[model samples]
Target: MTQTPALQMTDVTLEYPDGRDGTLRALDDVDFTAEVGTITSLVGPSGSGKSSLLAVAATLLTPTSGSVRINGREVTELTEKHRAGLRRDEVGLIFQQPNLLPSLTALEQLVIVDDLRGKPRRRARERGAEILDHVGLAESCSRRPHELSGGQRQRVNIARALMSEPSVLLVDEPTAALDHERSEEVVTLLCRITRERGTATVMVTHDTDFVPLTDAMVTMRDGVLSASAHRGSPDAGSTRRSDRPGSSPG
Candidate 1:
C-alpha cells in the first residue's frame, strides 16, 4: 500500500510588503514533503526563507499562492477557524525557544494544549504522561519551565507538541539555544520520537550537526529548494560521523 504524505507543499510562494516598492519574497515556488515516520531537516543561512516555510506550514502565516496540505487535506483554502482547528489537530509546532508558560507546570502545559483543542483535559493527562515519558521528561512533569535546564525545557516543549499525536510536526531552529551536546541529544531524541510515533517532522535549522540525523536534508536559498547529499535515505538510525567544516568538531 502507498503511504499518504504527512505534508505536501506545491509551488508555494509567500511575500511581505516592502516599505514603498515591490514585495520581498520569503518563499518562491518552494515545494517539499515529509512522509510519516520520517524527519526532513531544512538548513540554510539567515534570510533563506526557512522560518517563512515553517510559519506557512504551521498556518501561522499564509502564503501568497500555492497549496499547503496536511494528511491529504488542503489547508490553504481553510477558513481561519478551520485552519486553527487543523493546526491544533493535525500539526505540532516547536520553536527555537522553549516558549513555555512560566506559571504553568510541565503537566499543566500539555494539559492546557489539549484543552485549547477542545479535547477532554482528563483524556489528555494520560497522553501527556505517555509523551513526557517518551521524551525522557516523565519526572519533570510538576516542574515549571524556569526550574528546568535549557535542554529539559526543550524536551518539555517537544513533549507538549506531541501530546496531541499530530500527523505533521513543524519545528523551527530547535537547537538554536542549546549547547553542542545538548543540541545533538535533542536532535537524536526528535529523530527517535518521529519514528516511534510515525510523525512526519520538518525542522528548520542552521545547525550542520543535525544534517546527518535526518531522513532527508534540504536547503533553501533565495526562496528555492535544493536537495543535499548529506542524508542518504529515510531511515532513522543511519547517521555516520564525519568532519563537517564550520561545524564544532564535537
Candidate 2:
C-alpha cells in the first residue's frame, strides 16, 4: 500500500511588499512534498526563497496564492489562530540557530514548550528527558546552552522540536555552523530520526557535500524549483552519487 505524503505544497506563492507600492515574489508557484519516513533536502542560493517556503509551510507566514497541506489538510485558508495551532501541534521547526534561551537549561527548554501548550510542566519534564536522550543530549540535560558546544546546542534544538511529537519536522540549515565532522554527524542523526520516528522531514541546507545523505534533493533557484533527485530510483540525487564530490561508495 502507498502512504500519504506528510507535507504537501501545491502551487504555493508568497509575496513581500516591495518599496513604494510594489510587490516582490519571494516564492513563485512552488510545489513540493516530503513523504513520511523519508528525508528531503532543499538546496538553494541565499535569496532563492527557501526560508520563505519554510515559513509558509510552518504556518509562520501565509501564502499569497495556492494551498499548504499537512497530512492532507488544506491549511492555507485557516485563520491566524488555527494556523498557529497547526504549527504548535502538527509542525516542528528546527531553526538555523539553536535559539535556546540563555537562562533555561537544556531540559527546561522543552519543559517550557509544554507549558506554552497548556500542559503540565512535570509531565512535560518526563517527556523532555526521553527526547533529550533521543538526540544524544541526555548527559547535557542540566547544562545551560552557554555550557554546551555548538553541535550539542543544535541537538538540543532538534530534541525540543520533537518534544511535542509533531508529524512534520521543518529543519533550517541544521549544520550551517558546524565543522565537517560535526555537520556529517548531525545529518546522519537527522536521517536516523526520520526513519525511526516515521516523521516527514524537510531540511534546508546550502551544503552540497551532504546531499547524498538524504533520500532526495530539490534545488531552488530564483524563487523556483528547477532540479530534483530521489533515492533508490532514476533520480538525480541517488543514481549519480559518484558524480558528487566527497561522495562515498555505497
Candidate 3:
C-alpha cells in the first residue's frame, strides 16, 4: 500500500467578496500534498495565491469547496473548534517574520507557547531546551532576539514552530528578509528538520536558490498549482551526515 500523505489539499477553492460584492476566487481548484519526511516548495508571483494556500493548509481559512486533509484526516469538513485544535496540535507555521517578542529570551519564546497550552512552566522549558538544542541554539538559549543574529532569530522561529511536534509545517516566505548566505542556511535547516522529524513541510519561497534543496518544487500561477518538479541539487533527497550543519570543512 502507498504511504499516506502528511498533508493533502484536493480541489480546494477559496473565494472572497470583491469590493463590488462579487466573488473573487483566490484559489481555484488547487490540489497539493506533502508527504512525510519530505519538503515541498511553492513558488509564485504576488497575488498568485501562495499565501492563501498556506492559510488553508494551516486551517486558518476554510475553503469555499474541496477538501484538506492533515495526517490523512479530512480537516476541511471539520468544525471550527476541531480545526482550531488541529492548528494548535498538528500544524506549525513559520511566518516570514520571526515575530519574536524582544522582551523574551530565545528559550522563553518557545516555552511561552507551551505555557499557553497549559503545560507546566518547568516541563515547558525542558521541552524548549530540547528543541532549541536540536536546532543548534543551545549556547544562545538565554539571549534575547536583539542579542542574536538574523539567522539565529530565524532558527528560534523554526524551533518554536517545531515545539508542538507538528505533523505538518506551513512556512510563509521564510527567506524574504535574509541575505543569500542566511537564506541558504535557513533553508538547509528547514530541510534538515523536516527529514529528521518526519514532518511534511510546505514552504513558500520567492528565492529559486532554495528550490534545489527541496524534495519537490511546485509552481503556482493565478491560484493554480502545476505538476511536480525537482532541482536535483544533491540535497534534494534524504538528509545525510554531510548535509548536517557544521559538517563542511573550511
Q: What is the C-alpha RMSD of each candidate to the true structure, in Å?
A: 6.9, 6.3, 8.9
Q: Report the number of clashing residue pairs per model.
A: 0, 0, 0
lDDT of each: 0.83, 0.85, 0.86
Model 2 lDDT-worst window of ten? 233-242
lDDT (tens digit, per residue) of candidate 3 on 1-250: 9888888787788999998979888887776778888898888899998899999999999999988889889988888998888898999999999999999999999999998788899989999999999989999999999999989999999999988899999999898989999999999999999999999898999998878888888777877766455755222222222223565621
lDDT at residue 204 of model 1 (Cα atoms): 89
Once fitted onto the true fold, the runs of candidate 1 whose alpha carbons sit more than 4 angstroms away are 229-231, 234-250
**Lowest summed lDDT window (length 10), candidate 3:** 234-243
**Ranking of models by lDDT:** 3, 2, 1
Q: What does candidate 1's lDDT look like per residue over 1-250, in tens digits? A: 9776888887788999989888999888776777898888888889988889899988888899988888888888889999988888888999889889999999999999888778887889988988888889889989998899999999999998987789999889899888999999999999999998899998888888777888888778877766654445633211111223343422
lDDT of 2 by residue, 13-43 (tens): 7888999799999877776777788888889
Top candidate, metric lDDT = 3
Off by over 4 Å in 3: 231-250
Candidate 3 clash figure, as a count: 0
TM-score, ranked from best to worst:
3, 2, 1
Worst 10-residue stretch by lDDT in candidate 1?
Answer: 236-245
Q: Is candidate 2 or 3 superior in lDDT?
A: 3
